[model samples]
Target: GAGVSQSPSNKVTEKGKDVELRCDPISGHTALYWYRQSLGQGLEFLIYFQGNSAPDKSGLPSDRFSAERTGGSVSTLTIQRTQQEDSAVYLCASSHGGTDYGYTFGSGTRLTVV
Candidate 1:
């Protein structure tokens, strides 16, 4: 894909269920990020992957949240034991690896935990 892509635009799951969100970054992009945004709330950084460096997991809210980038391209975010508080739009973004480069964001996956 020429731009960042995410799958299953919307998902509704029961509490305690697990969900996996996928992200396909633009070709050649070296930076990928995952963020969560609750209704009427601001974006919260979840994780970040850059080139061959170790992934930055500092932003993850809990051990149940995890993510991985494969071949420096596609990435997946997994949420275990979904909770009502975890309901939010998960956004994925890719960039060319610098502050000067603008990011291309996916439409985001809306997760609703009930």
Candidate 2:
């Protein structure tokens, strides 16, 4: 994909179920990030991967939230045992490196819990 790509632009799942979201970053980008946004709330950083080194996993909300980047290109975010409070827009973003470059974001996967 030329730009960031996210699957299942929208997802509706019952509480307690697990869901996985995918992200495809731009070609050659080494910095990948995930964020969660709730109504009236600004973007919350979830995690970041720089190259093939250890990712900056400082923003994951909980143990249930996890992500991985393979080939330093595509990535996936998995939310285990969803909760109603977990409903939000899961956004994926990527930058050229880690030096504050402009980030390109995915359209996002809107997850609705019930």
Find the candidate with the highest TM-score and give its number.
1
Model 1, span 84-110: residue lDDT tens: 999999999999987646789999999
Give the Cα lDDT of each candidate. 0.94, 0.93
lDDT of 2 by residue, 11-87 (tens): 99999999999999998888999999998899999999988889989999899999999888889999999999999
Candidate 2's TM-score reads: 0.95
lDDT leader = 1
Clashes of each: 0, 0
lDDT of 2 at 71: 85
lDDT of 1 at 114: 95
Scored against the true structure, residue 113 in model 2 reaches a CA lDDT of 93
TM-score of each: 0.96, 0.95
Lowest summed lDDT window (length 10), candidate 1: 94-103
lDDT of 2 at 68: 92
How does model 1 fare in lDDT?
A: 0.94
